[model samples]
Each structure stands twice: as structure tokens, then as C-alpha cells.
Target chain A: MKFSVMVNEGPYNHQASDSAYHFTKAVLQAGHEVFRVFFYHDGVNNGTRLTTPPQDDRNVVARWSELAVEHKVDLVVCVAAAQRRGIADADEAKRNGKNADNIAEGFRISGLGQLIEAGIVSDRLVEFGD
Target chain B: MPTVKKMMYVNRRAPHGTGYALEGLEVVLIGTAFEQEVCMAFIGDGVYQIMQGQDTRAAGMKNFSPTYKALGDYDVTRLYVEQESLSERGLSVDDLMPLTYEDEDDDWAEKPSVQVIVRKELSQIMAAQDVLFNF
Candidate 1:
């Protein structure tokens, strides 16, 4: 079964993103395809490359980046929400005339339409939020 | 096939204190463009979102009660209120704003949108959904 995961809250402050990450991992491990993982609302904060957790703590942002690299999972962050929260990739930063870009590796910034598309195409769309 | 997926929106938060209820409604509104089979269930504190005569003026928040009335115009019907959630909050159908939709198939007759359901039945609705939006 193809599964689409949605995380609606920021990491650490809320366990939403973390729970989504684990669920996505388990889905992949169970031989199920993860259609996409769309980050919306405060969940876009998990895509910032600048976040540096302590040495022992889990790096939520880096874990997602690694998931993208290892599993080739599609990690999408909502562009409108990301813009308001200051998360932009290189292309978006250049287009919007912003000085700095903080989008972590493996995550792409897109519109809410991508989220809708994921729901349309995937068999199951699971959401994690407060 | 009609390509109409079973979609369920499970709301479990209050109207204010956060953007969940408002944004959740916006998602449902946008989702109507797909013409999917969508249903919304109010559980836990989420039932408060339908409380009638909600006055958010004191908190400087936008009163969004009017939008629920407009949902039927957009064909975003099937609003379900959990009986347990309402009873736990000491509320009943009288405390809620009645929502209705026009059935064009049935000569455009008006029909009530909000369906008061028990928690178990609401769970069955949730399990049957292809896409579950929890906000």
C-alpha cells in the first residue's frame, strides 16, 4: 500500500514530526511505499538546515535529510507555510530575493497542492498533529 | 470509476487557542474542488467549534462561525458531531449552529449537514476513510 504522511507541527515542541518520521520508516521497512511526506504549518520548521541539536539528542532535521538520501523518500514542505516561517531552498531564496536559505537537504518546498495531490494519488494519507 | 476517495477530517481541538480548527476548515474547503467523498467529525474539544453564537470579539480573533454556513454552497457537506464529545463538554445539539446543504439531485431541497453520531460509529467512519486529515 502507498502511504502519504503529513506532519503539522514543529519537531521537539510537538512529537508530531517525530511520530511521522517513525511511521514513515516503519512503512518503508514493512515493504510499503511512502508516496510522500508533506510538512505543513509548523511542521515546516523541521526542514531548516540550521537547527543543531545537542551531541546526544536526535537531530530531527538531519534525520529527515538522511531518510531522503537512504530511502529516497519524497519529503515536501509547504511553500506558503515555509515562507512565513523562514524556510527556503536556494532557488526559492534567489527568486524571492532573500539573502539566506535554510532548507535542509532532501526536502523540497512546494505548494499545498502537492499535499492535495498526495492525498489523491496515495491509498492512505496519515496525519500527525497536535 | 468516479475517483471519489473516502476522506475524513478528524478535528480534536478547540476553535481558537490555535490555528488547527480554522486551517482545518480551509483544507476541507480546498478539498471540495476534488469532488471527493468527504466527511468531518468533531471529537474531543473539537465539538466546540460548532458552538452557536460564538463571540470572539473580546480576544481580537476572527469569528469564523459564518463559514460553516457557507460550506454547503461549496458542496462540502457531511459534518458529524460526536455525541460523546458534546456530552463530555456538557453541550447538546441546542448549543450548536445547525448546518444544511442543498441537494441538487433531489430537486435542490435543503438537508441538515450536521449528523450527531456516537464515538464508535465515528471510528468506523474514520477507518473507512482513504485520507484522514487530523487537524
Candidate 2:
């Protein structure tokens, strides 16, 4: 089945993000297709390209990027949620006059409408939040 | 025959810790108003939402746990609990908000059509749903 996974929790500081990562891996291993992974609310933090976790610990940002690359999944971060939380891509940073760009590659800053679109096109939509 | 839209909502946060849970509840209410079938699953900290006692005025937030009781009125009846999360928090089935409880069964082959799972299990559970919304 085609799936659209929603990540609504931050990457670190909470188990939610880690859980999201492991779950994504499991889905892929089970031979299912991930149509997209949309980030919203605090989950937008997963898009930070500037994050630098300890080399020893699991680097979540890199993990997500790798997952997207391996599976060719569409990783979209909510534009409104990102800006509100200071997660900006290069274009968004320029538009907003922010000096820094934090959105990691393989993830694009988009809108909630993408989520709605996923609902319409995908067979299943799974959300991980709070 | 009319096909009832069964929407399974999974809530993962405490009642007042953030707005995701409440906003999610609102969506479910709206779904019901639109004649969609809605079921709820509380995993991880979301179990706190259905706890017997909640006081929000102290936080200057509107109290909405009462709205939970109204879910039954909306025809939202199924509420599932993750056995691991409940056991981890030392919570028993009795501590939840007067809902039926289901443990993680070993037989994944005969699992419920849909399930509410913890953070670790979310991806798999989400893949199974026709529509999954996480808050």
C-alpha cells in the first residue's frame, strides 16, 4: 500500500521523533512504499540541516535524509510551521530575510495543502505527532 | 447501503502539554459532524488526556476533557490502548477514560483492522490505516 506519514513531533528531546524514524525503517523493510513524509508542528525540527548530534548517538537528521534518498520518498516540511519554529530552507530564509538556512536537503519546505493532497492520492495516511 | 467512514484517531500527547491533541479531537468531532465514523487510540502520553482528573484553568487553557465524554454522543465508540505504554507508566486499564482496552497481540496476522501504537510502532500502524492523523 502507498503511505503518507506525518511527523508532528520534534527530532530530539522526545521519543516521538526517534519512534518515527524506526517506524519508517520498519515500513520499508516490510516492503511497503512510502509516498511521502510530511513534517508539521514541532516535527518541523527534523528538517534542520544545521543540526549536529553527537557522532556516537543516532543522528536523526541524517537518518531521515538517508531514508528519503534510499526510498526516494518525498519529505515535505510545513512552511508555516517551519518559519514559526525557525526552521527555514535557503529560499524561505531569503524570503523572510533570515540570515540562516536550516532545512536539510531531501526535504522541501511546503504547505499543509500537501498533506491534504496526500490524503486524496494515497491509500493510507499515517501521522506521528505530539 | 450507506458506508460509514471509520476514522481511527491516535493521540500521543498529554491533555494540556500542547495543542495537537485538542486540535486533533476537534477534527474528529468535525468528522463526526460530517457523518464519518471516528475511533480513538491513546498511546504514550496521550493516555493522560483520558485520565479521570484534569485541571486546565491553572494553565489558562480551556478545559475540554468534558468533550471526551461527548464523543460517545457523536457515535465515536472504539478507543484502543497500547499495552506497553500503559504498563510502562504503571497505569492499569481502570485508569483510562472509561474505554475498552486491547493489548499488543503476538499474532500480527489477526490484528485489528487498525490499531493505535506507541512512537516505536507508529509507522507500521500508520501504514495500515486508510487515513492516519497524528497529533
Best by lDDT: 1
What tens digits encode model 2's per-residue C-alpha lDDT throughout A1-130?
Answer: 7777888788777777787778878888888888888887788999988889888898899889998888888999888778778998889999999898988879998866677556656676776754
TM-score for predicted model 1 compared with the true structure: 0.88
DockQ score of candidate 2?
0.16
Off by over 4 Å in 2: B1-16, B21-132
Error of 1 at A8 (Å): 2.2
What is every candidate's alpha-carbon RMSD to the true fold?
A: 2.4, 9.8
Pairs of residues at least 3 apart in sequence or in different chains that clash in candidate 1: none
Candidate 2 chain B minimal-lDDT segment of 10 residues: B107-116
lDDT of 1 at B80: 91
Q: Can you give the TM-score per candidate against the true fold?
A: 0.88, 0.57
CAPRI band for model 1 = medium
